[model samples]
Target chain A: MSPGSVGTVATQHLDLPGSLPLDCGRSLRRVRVAYETYGTLSPARDNVILVCHALSGDAHAAGLSPDPPPEGTRDGFAAAASPKGIGWWDGMIGPGKAFDTDRFFVVSTNLLGGCRGTTGPSSTDPDTGRPYGSAFPVITVADMVRCERAFLAELRIDRLAAVAGGSLGGMQALEWATSYPDQVNNIVVIASTHALQPQGVAWNAIARESIMRDPAWQGGDYYGTGRAPDAGMGVARMVGHITYLSAPSLAEKFGRRLQSGGDLRYTLHEPEFEVESYLRHQASSFVRRFDANTYLHLSRALTYFQLDLPAAAETIMARTLLIAFSSDWLYPPSASEEIFDALRKSGKEAEFHLIDAPYGHDCFLLEEARQTPIVRDFLTEGRA
Target chain B: MSPGSVGTVATQHLDLPGSLPLDCGRSLRRVRVAYETYGTLSPARDNVILVCHALSGDAHAAGLSPDPPPEGTRDGFAAAASPKGIGWWDGMIGPGKAFDTDRFFVVSTNLLGGCRGTTGPSSTDPDTGRPYGSAFPVITVADMVRCERAFLAELRIDRLAAVAGGSLGGMQALEWATSYPDQVNNIVVIASTHALQPQGVAWNAIARESIMRDPAWQGGDYYGTGRAPDAGMGVARMVGHITYLSAPSLAEKFGRRLQSGGDLRYTLHEPEFEVESYLRHQASSFVRRFDANTYLHLSRALTYFQLDLPAAAETIMARTLLIAFSSDWLYPPSASEEIFDALRKSGKEAEFHLIDAPYGHDCFLLEEARQTPIVRDFLTEGRA
Candidate 1:
């Protein structure tokens, strides 16, 4: 394995004896969850910060161990490098950023429906010894949060200093605060909402449909087969990539400029404009590290997210800070306002800020001077 | 034989003989254009108002003859009923509306590469007698305008009282002034721009990809194959429909409401929210009337549109009105400013108005009260 790559972590399975009734007509039995952790736990075990990844993200959040595993032996759990890997969150995390690694013990785990060393559709069914694929039970954001809590208990972490994330990660952060209020002290929800809007669900449904419609999908059981649903997955990624950007950002990066040819071929098959090529690149990169079934699962989970439970808000233990962007269409500024209103109505300690950024929904991932002070002040307040 | 369908118009074919050199290195030839017309041509042939339609709209601008054609007739050019039929443009193009049908002899024609009465990818290729499908040559907005000019000449109309349209129709109106400066008198371009922005192209590309990736697409030759690419086309429409509405509209229409059931299903395959169902409805309606190949062709044409021909601006017909909406994201207010600036710089008669409407990009199609006065004043000015 490459340096800084986290090899396949050991899977510890647990069978929760009772059955939990789901919103769907089905019930889950003997629920088993798999997870991973990073950094050393403090004596008090109260400095934990749970990092939840987005739909395609995994448990590998930060640095790798010094002893590396053999190459190809850590395919699933190995933390894949981003185009600018650790640098993707350089301004927000590290030794000196808001999520300072030197002070807090960060624990980033693979989501329940994820394929990165987690019990997802790609996992082998213990009974049939084949990939679960279509047979795997569908999951929700609440279920994923439950799995994270289970992983923390297994690691002996009793409480969390804060739970924070953006996009789907932000959704998980909100869930953490509501489902297990006593376990979290502070909550930072960035570029997210209480639930998915129709536009958001509509986009997700199309992406899911694209993957399932691919012939190579083989009803989601394509594992062990030489061919994968690359085409469908690529199309789905293209859709997601579009949502991740603000309109202004796309125009700045790839205007009506033609590709290297300097001229457009009036043919439907060929990509005439530079924007088409740019989207194709984003799609191809995603297919390399993601599983089709996992994408479908996670997208659905996001669509079903809801924090309207009276009980969840009534038992809140953490003070919340909601951050939103002006140009984010996917999770617009209005979404942040709704969450802030909910917290206020519940008589909870909550603060909201709408950051002026033209980078759209993904502004949280970009570097802006305005965000630094806001985040710094929030994280450093009343710290022991 | 549907009573109100726009497919009943008799089509007149014109073989365009001009070989215009394009910026795209490729030269187009043997351009066969199919079109339709409405209203009687005055003896002077000067009282003409050109009507343009949106992306999926056809030339059957208005009116349906009470006399029906005999059954089993294979004639494809009879004027068909509009989707909205008589009520669609009730506020704009009735007897005494802004487009006063009694005074002006209105003309509307199906665009080139359109599946309606016009020659498009679905039309039998003269060279092969087979549907062009994926093999159809890509077209540009300028090419579409070129075909429109031919349709106008065949009707013996030398000049138009005003050229008006919304969205893609608005694009054609602007192109008319730039491509054939002297032929147009008054130009009313609403909720449109000189070129497709990066965000617009990105959305269009995703929509096209969704259709192409569908297995039923059959490389664009799904016609007569029983299985159409409805899933992919529906997904494409859903993406477009989102861009047409404002964030405020979406929140108000489908907040966090659950679909019929109050419970949240933990499954990935089911839609636990009401918003997903709403999008599905929108997507399904679009697929029923649109052809996948035509959608792909027209979307690409919209992306390639650019009417800022500096040299042509000096010679453009005077008297132009540019209208934009504050909430329109697809064609933001800034785009309208660009057009207004160009016309003013060229010392032409031009006026720009930014209407404050919360309907997003579809404001022009929805707000008739605001659009009526603006259009009426522009067209009535300096009229005979």
Candidate 2:
């Protein structure tokens, strides 16, 4: 179906209690979760598939609702505005695509520490009745998976057909399989690793620092002021954009061509090259949609993701597929190798494929040619 | 020579007019050249070896004077500090080193449009009596070589020995032989190219744009205001530093390691990885010593460099040795192949060697084991 064809489903707020004790020796109470669903659930609810998002992703995943509200009708907290966009992953979730909306019902949710309809730094602190800001409890990947389980319970889904995602979403998929092996039958982890390598965490650290240093951040409590840390967020996006592309991809695309006009401006303010303008546009676009605090929170959660698999072989019940990109420096093929090795050692039916693409870590989002058949065969043929 | 062996030697500055008109359609006038000499000039003065610096190098090419002044004492209207106390190329030049001090009278100068003791954007505008700033004329690589010729004239030295350098310095060395064939006898173009391809230019453009976009740049007129564009310059340096190193180097040095003591802050302000901190330090050090405008000027000059040899393949006069590093993405071995092919096609005696080093573009600066013998043999043995 085309955009805006699906009907909107009202979601109930979920309160999930924190799992781990906080650093302050206290446990967080009443964690709230927000989510959206597509297609119809079967009588067994075993046909449910969960889609997780990356660092800046929100809950509105795939299939636009019919009679959607006009653009900007609900301010920043409402659904994303573009007609073609309910979520960033809409392309993979529709009829006969990867997620196959026709057969299996799909669910996507905003993470615990997210800005969109979830309990985050932007959410009100029940004790203070104001935004949590810096006071929002720091969280881990297990905590996020706990909230996802809560969302699943709210929908009365006892078991999921599969859980799949890329990047941070991929991390969540792995977390689901490991934390609740019986809950998930099929797991597809794309371009993600068991833990954040120092390099990955380093990049996120810089992005976070860029936001926190912005005067507009106001210690993460700038929601009412309307002066978000746009500049800092822009810088973060620029850095993130660089990491998303391989060196060869950058060389092929922008390779130092001057601006449209002939001569160099010989000044600093003017655009000297086209790539600079492209990066500037990317930075600007990111700042408009993403909350700086949420960016920080989600990035940290992704970094903290570590799966505690069964020590003995044959313990993991879920059949696994690990996909990586050859040029994805962020989560290279080596990471996939680690997962594949772990699954093999555990006597689980596992497969690994490294798509040869020059797009770097972003290949998962764009390499449809390489991904389609591999994912389709693995999901359809493997036991679930 | 421990940095203070050189005694008194007369120095001079000469002006060379640009051959082509700038973007403003104004031809540069009296393009001032600053240079220094070490060791006594032979009776014939044919023993002079011209030394060139990389993108941000200056005229202090050799030993410091016996009586050195305080830092910034001789600011000399350039964006970088005076090279009066220590020379950047001191490591390879001296008593019995590669370019032996007693045998060859070395001549090193600040390049045209350079900030260190040379006529660049920070130089006084003849009409306005203020720094040229954004009004400074755009310069070409050929123009820079011509200006070097003027400096040679002032020194009463007609080159007979050799010209050598790494990176941009190597580019100048190549230009010297092509632009003034009769004025040179031997040439060593190390880790450089005739023209910067799109990949190299892409990195340069990003770095240049970063400096220009910094608010402190003030349209390239931040001189005397003590408000240089440190942010932009820092970004520029960060980009350049990446090019100077290979992926393997980064992986080995900073791979995913957290900062010394702290855990991930879950905010955007702290460096999560050691590599990020390393990059920050590199950027900061560069901005402290180099000018933003000079970076733009030199990068543009590199982009425009082309060897103009008349006659299809038989007109190359100067004996040339082309050296490149396998891992140097900035000036890849492919570019050096083009240079070697052109020279060989002309039936010229040319030698090319691709040194295998993993340090990337900066390999030329650090690979002493590979460099010493090659450079020493090429310079000392031969056709004179």
Candidate 3:
């Protein structure tokens, strides 16, 4: 693989052959998976690595767009995929980076319930010929994994060199290992949990409530309306952003520092603290890009995550590496400990590491210096 | 002193004679303070103990209503002062409890910017004959203490036996000792800080934002409309409630427990977890009783709290007792440490205790067994 081959990337769609059986005992048909890929498939097709995204992530995982992104990228992409096409994991996936495109084929797909190019709430319904919106079926972590597995089938990849992600992406990594233990040889999970803690669940619930309570939400049927539930979505994003950064990080960055041009006194209106101004900016920008119904679906899926599959424990074969951040209150050290303990109990080889970082849940995304070497070593040294 | 004397509690109002100057350099005239007293004042007024209420607290500190509370109790009171007039500190302010009404005359007053029968945003402006609303002057911890000082002067009490409170009330107690060093003999502050931390300020800012964003807020002048910004206030209360309780406590009480009627799987429209239901109830009840404008004012005051008073180091003559809960992230142990270190550096006799409790910031309010003895011992054994 060369840098030139990875530089020009576009989202590609595949119509999955069969209906996906959901965790809710329902089935989804006419499933279209949108994905992006880099590197090349080895002759044996064993160099494939699947990259799953967390909540609000998309298929645009890497590459710089010399040209504009694929046509459907903007219509539903929840994350900030640059028009220049820089991916979320752009730092970790070049010729010599962690994934090391020279030796590994990388596949990144938007989650099933995402608003991106993949079929989700913002996608048109085959039966009604309209966006799914409120009519979209609720999706679980298992359902998302099933769609990705189908995508793997479409690519004719029999086994994976590794499956990796952070946060909700990490959740999918765990699910991939458990759902099909024989297919994955290595799994890297970062700053994530098997199931949502009560506090995490509460935050998700409140975020959803903030959206639902918006008059413009219109019971998740705001797609046809000119106005989306941007206020509710903005509040949700603000709340989520707070959890993404550590308290110490906020204190160090903003402190009680008043916003520039604002008086250091109390007021009934106006942003006072720098943190408030920052949060406002984060919320406003998020509402303009993300789909509210997709947010609702994905957030709900997070609450339903359960890694206690008895059958998976018995058959699990993946060599696992679990990483937790010191300040990630959303997915704390204890959450990773639970997964580590469960894997060891099941007679699997699992390694756990806690990184000391102030970025909180976002440490996995930002601390590339610390992460790249560890990930490269794990991916390279473990395989036959 | 007798239990019978304490049982016949009465709420008293005093119209302050002079214009009350604010920390913001504004003067508030026609100031009226509503307070409730238990037990009789000593002959020398030396046994008078002043109790300062927290953000949502009122003059009704402890008492059972024979029939029901006064008419205005519900209209303005910030906290859950039952119609039967049960005090906020019911467990620790009785005949033989911490404050021991039998031994000390106890006085609790609503803060200046509070809605609870105090001249606040809900109170009428003498000039316009309408609610002050946004016109109500931004207040500080010092202003609240000043109003309490006036109450003390009206009662002809030269010195206090003690001044005590928790949370925002704790801020007031610190203010009482520092602002008028000669008037307060002892100060007991619990689950509070010398100043608000950046995270605390952020939370308060978000809560206030939640309320201010409500369309019904109407620039803080909804008095004639007969409609309050309940949705915004409810969201604010929900956010506040999350900070008040610890993650461990929430996990222990409602760990992934689903609401009884909800299904086990993901749903976009319903409250799934028990914690979500619980928070919703908390928010709904809070908005019904709390005044939105007052929430804004009080929350802002919390951000402005500062114990860096130049005179406090030299003039704070009160014997101090500072209690911090280990799980209180809002006002953590470090917060109390700041206050304790300040008091000790000032050459004051101060005792500090960090109680290990899972109740978070509300530990001071809920852990009566732990706090009652510490407070009683400090008040009874410290005076020379």
| Candidate closest to the true structure, highest lDDT | 3
**lDDT tens digits by residue: candidate 3, B83-146:** 3555677667878889887888888888898787888999999879999987888888888888
By DockQ thresholds, what CAPRI class is model 3?
A: medium
Expressed as tens digits, the lDDT of each residue in B1-384 for candidate 2 is 344345343345666554434543566665687778776688987787888878866777656644443442122112144356656566466666666777778888888888777788888887788888988877776667767776676666666577887788888887777667777777888888876765565566556655665567777788899888776666666666666777666777666666755455543354556776776766666666777888888877776565543342244477787889998877888878888888888788788999998878877666645776776677777453
Tens-place lDDT per residue, model 1, A89-129, is: 33455554576666777667677868767777887776588
True contacts recovered per prediction: 0.74, 0.23, 0.57
The C-alpha TM-scores of every prediction are: 0.87, 0.83, 0.92
Residue B101 of model 1: what lDDT?
A: 61
Best candidate, DockQ: 3
lDDT of 2 by residue, A1-384 (tens): 464234344434666655434432445566678777878898877788898877777777665544343321112112234453445565567666677777778888888788778778888887788888878767777677777887687678879889888888888888788778888899888999876665565566556655665567788888788788776677767777777777678767776666866656654454566666777667666666667888887876776565544452235568888999998887878877887887888778889998888888877776755787787788788654
Reference-based lDDT, residue A220, model 3: 79
lDDT of residue A103 for candidate 2:
72
Q: Model 2: which residue pairs collide?
A: A198-B256, A199-B256, A208-B268, A209-B268, A209-B269, A268-B212, A314-A346, B78-B115, B79-B115, B313-B346
- Give the lDDT ranking, best first: 3, 1, 2
lDDT of 3 at B292: 93
| i-RMS for every candidate | 2.1, 4.1, 1.4
